[model samples]
Target: MIYLLSDLDFSLPLSNPVVVFSLVLFIILFAPILFNKIKVPHIIGLILAGMIVGPYGLNLLLRDSSIVLFGTVGLLYIMFTAGLEIDLEEFRKNRITSLVFGLFTFLLPIGLGSVAVYYVLNFSWPTAILVASMFATHTLLAYPIASKYGINRIRSVTLTIGGTIITDILALLVLAAVIGTTRGDIDATFWVQLAISTLVFGAIIFFVFPLIARWFFKKFEDAVSQYIFVLAMVFLGAFLAELAGLEHIIGAFLAGLALNRFIPHSSALMNRIEFVGNAFFIPFFLISVGMLIDFSVLFKGLGALKVAAVMTVLGVLTKYLAALLTQKTFRLSPLERGMIYGLSTARVGATLAIVLVGYNIIIGETPTGEPIRLLNEDVLNGTIIMILITCTISSFVVERTAQQLALQEENVPRDEGDSNERILISLAYPDTVTELIDFGMMLKPRHSNVPVYALNIISDESDNGKTKTIAKKMMDKAVHHAAATEQTILPLTRFDVNVSNGIIYTLKEQNITDLIIGLHRSANQHNFLGATADSILRHTSETIFIYKSVQPFNTLKRLVVVVTIKAELEPGFAHWFSKLTTIAKEAGLPIDFFATPETIKELQDQQAAQKAEVKISCHAFSNWDDFLIFSREVKKDDLLVIVSSRKDHVSYQPSLEKLPYYLSNYFGSNSFIMLYPQQVERGIKMDDVQFVDGSLAETISDSVAQVSKAGRLWKRLFRKV
Candidate 1:
């Protein structure tokens, strides 16, 4: 081992595959940490490290097959992840804006680029067109920065992402045309073939792949198998795209879209995919891009420098012009326009692909009968330099603009109405405490001052002290989880003979305006809200939310709210609506409101009157039975919310009791919440008596006698079982 260690020297060119792999891994692991300390973008650091070890610099590493393999994987991973992370609902809403930006960004750059290349560089028409197409393609290099700052859901960001898809596809198509024309294959048949093949490719990826994935996911329960299946789909999409005469990135992106609804962002499968890509594949691709840059060429003469400067200036200027036009047309703010420009300026994947394709094409012959290259070595090197410059500028600009946008949003007051709302989550199981806390945070108004309470109730059994200690540990875990999001949770522990009584005591003591409790399953396969959640729902006038999450809250793509008839008449309707809207905004999902015609009209009137921030689409449903049809459409990544009422209330119906049963049978794997809105007071009459079984009967019987003696005593005083 010592002899082998002595023989291994990384300073020199390392041919052993194992040694090369180790050295690259070391660079990947440490570059980000070292660069982060100095406040430099980790991506830039990875690129710089790649340049250092590349054949052009220290000659310690060469661009071998391994680099090519990993680099390609990284490129696909980047596109796939982009599709996976995009807000589809937002994308659909901003499709027109995306199309406008796409056309402007593509046309402006190509027109400007071709004219400049042809007139200034004196290149031929074919060569000029090919070179111009390079400027029309860009990579979302600064997307991570926007995402990190939590501004990814902003309209500008979504528009930019949507435009990226359009422009990249268009640019790559132009590349194909240019390549075919140069290769002397530009005939009617060529166009027809390309068109037909692209359609076929889209059908397979968008329609067929989803069908297969749905069946596979339904049948397969193993986590590892699901992950491998997703990976397979990505590769299959890429391969199919190549067959259709399009770039593989297009296929990978389509694959991501195909699988988006099936795999929730908060699922373990998605976490695994992102982890592998960010940890290894993406960094490798960035490094590979950096390895293409030959600094020596820039120092050689003014010609290369001139080309690099011209390309970089033209790229940035054209993107800026496009963004300016878009901003004016859409009446967007200056900061939003800047963000659009910054996100759309960086040239990488498609740019490199176009340049390389152009470089390989032979358009003419020199005087000596040698093939004349469409892209010369100087042009290639200059393009690489432009890539480095644009990427750096794009990252810096995006970071600054995103931060500004975030700060501006923070300062702007949201019109959620004034209310000191507090949500208390009753913890029964330690495993679900963190998830429950996250759900509460999602429902809470952004930047609000209201505190979140996490309560753990210990039963007054023989092992009370030991249970309290365990409860404290669980509460601490929940507190730690909340702290990560910069949220403070008030932890409360109580001992009572009945768990439900303890929860009710804390709810009253803390004056909680809202209650969140977990939903479990009973032996009969029905959703068991437990005696605790049931008692609170029946007795408390405060709004109550019962949540059962099968996956992470962030994974939700849509918030489906089922509003019963006359739901609008409830006193706490506005409060629960505000909470629902807050969850939608925080989760970056649109709200699909299913309600009766009357209720829908009322809701629309109220929304128009109050200028709410949430995007809602209303669907009419006659009654609760419509939920079965709706459930069929609810994907795995959706959050199902049912707004209910207490017994004998105007909106209360017998059918509401069957909702939990339906949800359990159909959507057991999906996350759902049931809310019971607060009601107005009606004088209680001793003559109007209703029988309820279990703990509710005992508590209510005690409450009736106490109520006769003392007018409306607190419900907790009757809990002496």
Candidate 2:
């Protein structure tokens, strides 16, 4: 009888499960840290460390079953997270191509792989099925890499990704069929049952789950925020799989579909879950895999190498060829096709799980004392070897090819727009509004030189005249406070608008490119921050920006631009920086443009919104004012914007000092100050600008006069209508 270690030993406790678990988990967790220095993939280090201390090599220790549990859970979490991250919207954007490429990718590989495995490799049907699965898989890792080069959304990246997903779906389906065939219990009679079950499962998960999960999330349960719902569904899915005699993964995948919409910030949740997996589960799982590796199976190492080579070559060729077929359908290029091939080659993780299922099915029914079968033995070693080689090759190829395929940043047209109008923006105490204002001005059309109206509404508590006086006072204070801190102002606009409707009404009435906002933003009044934030989050259609402050503004030298070329320029974004250039002529601060890699890559595509930000950024202030409003994104900046007009635009909180949305809700006036270029360039001194010298009360009276005139005109227009 085997006895557990009776006592503790001072010797290096390589045999201790706890020590083994701790060391291995940490090694896996920290593996990627070193890659920061060398610019290498963390995955490389992860696999290496897994093999080193694994049972076969050093056998440093054994992980407790609990840690092993973590690994299993990690696998499920990884799949779920993968499902969540899939850009369904993006997929829809290129649906025709996605479908065509997806189907083509699937068909080409299966056809090629099936023939290669059956005829060339002389494998049986089951064996061919297994082999084809590996060849017909893809991963999305290349998507991010493509993004690094600023080209992920280009036609090439889109086609490749679309094709890759198609291939992956095909692989999963084939994997399911193979597993079913290998299971002796699932005879032909079971085929009808399987088909029915699949249909039922998909319908319930896709059509029904959204309705149910939405209700559950409305309760605002904090625990559910951590995705206890997902966990519960996963557990139920596993249970149902056992009850229904189906693969647990199928159930998990279905549950993923069910929970997709309910999960908030799934990427954030995924990060935490992936951390748990990385630190413990996946490492142990990989290590356990290493422990199972045996070198004694073949004396002729050349045979093993030959097998590895065949598998590797087959894997690469089938995937690339499949992707190319997809490209043919979707019109992808050579580089994108190569990337799809590399991504599809990431089958080891998923493929291995399927393999393990097969192994268990073949071996589970045997006596506990019975030895593993020859097929299991041969397949295990071969599969492992193939996977190891495939993974390494795939990673290298993906990284290299993706790197070689750079994102083509597009030419930002010099500001060309309809009219040169400055803008006025207002906001409350320092927050995301600053980013909005900065970006608004940066991406605004330079022709009209849209000026921002930074308006701050102050309630002389001495007068409670409005119907919603308390709400108005609170909102006004919030806006005033943000601008009082100088978070967003007119330097980003050609003009400023601080009339009526507070900031919120002003924003709603006019076209604003982007609205940067903060939630739970506090005010001196009975601040229902949560309600205010939630209300804004739910009701607003503008591209709302929300950010946690990470850096402080020092010098306003650098500016970032994010304007979707297709988006109509809001009044704030309508004014090009030509007015600012006029202002800059006085201030003498040079403006430079910076765009994220995503933006850089988007330039190549003939898409319009992608061009707006860049064009807005690269143009002269005077010429940009006429450009139509498109979407707006945030950038970092230091200079105060000088815009041309703030007639209708509202809230200019561009500095990072205040929340953009907060100012829009409260201080509609103090959001931005108007400085018209027509006045400044035509010998109107800085002091001559009315806003430069006016007190808040004086400005409000003037604003009230303008508001009264506008109200009368609106009435006249309404009557005419």
Candidate 3:
């Protein structure tokens, strides 16, 4: 016991690294749980715990280099997550709203806060401006709350995230100009250098980074390696931003934007990103924030108290006024206005960086030889207290507002049709399981409760023991991969006379609505449709997808869909269209639909009715005889979706008979999906399905109604005779 206590001298700001880590881990684990029980947010708990454990409180732990490093990463993670999760379509639609809010948030805070600072604090022009600019900048500390509540895709959140980058950029610019003037480095050369470097940084992040990232993802399939690569890119952006005379947070955010298209929100990579950040780094940063406060300073003098009070009031007021003005300008709801205010009110990250820079710059000395800094100690302490208050307020407001928004959204009913969708994926090859599951997920609705069915059908003639073992292994791999993305899949293994019979029987038994099967490698030379695929297509009418992937879905540049004329008349047209749009949205890829003018009009009408937010480029091309005419336009990386039909379907054309040959000969190297929509006769009927306990009451009712109708027809015939 003495040996164990030997390392514990009860020293202030504990020096033992192992002890420090253990204490922090424990705090992280329990602080949030305890705080949540009392109706307080976990964010506040971590922060308040930091205050207790930090040098300013009980001095149980020091805010050392490791703490600062992790804290910085946490800040960057917050910004990065914000950029990654933004609904790009919403952002694009309200780009002007974001810009307007950005301008208002920045100008109001600086314009109003500067005057107040200059007069109330008796600060000079430069010092006042530098201090005021800090108010203009806000960290996205409360963004995680919005993300947690699944409101990140909402328009108000998108606008806040977009406006965050804008305000941070403007605030950093003011900091540079003020610092440059104070250093007597304000010149044309300075302005030119800043502009040129910023442009270069933007180019690298937007252009060069994505190219490299796409290549990296295509080259490597390991989830861990992919996650590491993302982190490296994030830091690279941060380093480049520093080189460009900007804050690292801006670079981190830009990196997220650049990589957003490649990393789907529902992908495993995204799950890992959010999990790691929220679990450890973000909490550490929140705690470090709490450690920054030294409340004792507020008691030493009335001047410090005055400055703290003024800064706190002005900071909160200015951000509120900006949000209020934006709300009025856009005619947004009160909840939306509160959301914006909560997100933007927190003064951290860039704000802290700016204040520290101000405090470090020495201008002159007093008669007593005390140094007169750009920002004095009183202001710094005041800023720290202000950070605590605003962060607390921000977290509480965002938590409450996000909860309300989530509840409100839940109250709004979703389409009941989507809730009943049951997707089935037939997995045979080990190489395609991950891609198949991911593709299936892309086609699934977010609000759907049905788990995807992954079926592995074994031939009855095969060695049952050996084949079952191999199938189980494959199913395990599928289940594990699906689990990584926070999705659950029900694995089914069935044995029948043949693979096709097994798949067909399972589909019928499971009442599957959609079937996704990987294109078998056995289809060589003459057989474009392998035996199993041909059999399933001929026997079943559910939406079937023969997916032959040559590249990862995330790496695909665009979705090139070849729609047959009158294809919209099929029973599965709406279902297949929804799936295509879902994939496009999930992968952040634009869609190019090649169809006749009439078909294009139908597609346009469907898109409008669904309100699907994806870029759809329509090209009128009715030359079915010349299928290769548009081959040159489709890039090597594009995923071609050929919307085909059954033999006697309304959209089936003679030219479609040679489609497999055309695809094999011309676009052989390209990744493609041969989609066969459900035919009219094979459409799912309520009376034909089996429910719980194999009940068939609906089917019995249908049979009785049909017999009654035949009896009425017989009576009418007798009367006529």
Alpha-carbon RMSD, each predicted model: 7.6, 14.8, 6.6
Model 2 gets an lDDT of 0.47
* Model 2 Cα lDDT, one tens digit per residue, 1-721: 1235556543542756666556765876676687545766655556556666655556554444654565556545544544443444444567687677677656765777777767765667776766666666654433334444544435555555556545565676676677666655567667678678767766766766655565554444353365566576676765665455554544555576456434422123433444554456555554544444445544545555555556667776766666667667657667667776676665554566656765665434356667553135455566667666666666677677766665223343434433333344444443354433443343333222344544333333323355234434444444443343333343211122321224445455555534444333453234423443444433443333332232322123233332222111222222233333322322123443332233233322322532322222443122233221211322233332222222212222222222234334433322122222111111322122233234342322233224422234334333432
Name the best candidate (by TM-score): 3
Ranking by TM-score: 3, 1, 2
Q: Please report the TM-score between candidate 3 and the true structure.
A: 0.93
Query: Lowest lDDT 10-mer window, candidate 2?
Result: 673-682
TM-score of every prediction relative to native: 0.81, 0.56, 0.93
Model 3 vs truth, CA RMSD: 6.6
Q: Estimate, for each residue in 24-127, the C-alpha lDDT of model 3 and write its tens digit.
A: 99999999999999988899899999999999999998999999999999999998888888777778899999999999999998999899999998989988
Error of 2 at 429 (Å): 12
Ordered by lDDT, highest first, the candidates read 3, 1, 2
After superposition, which runs of candidate 2 have C-alpha atoms over 4 Å from their true positions?
1-18, 33-39, 63-68, 99-105, 119-122, 138-189, 221-227, 230-305, 360-376, 402-721
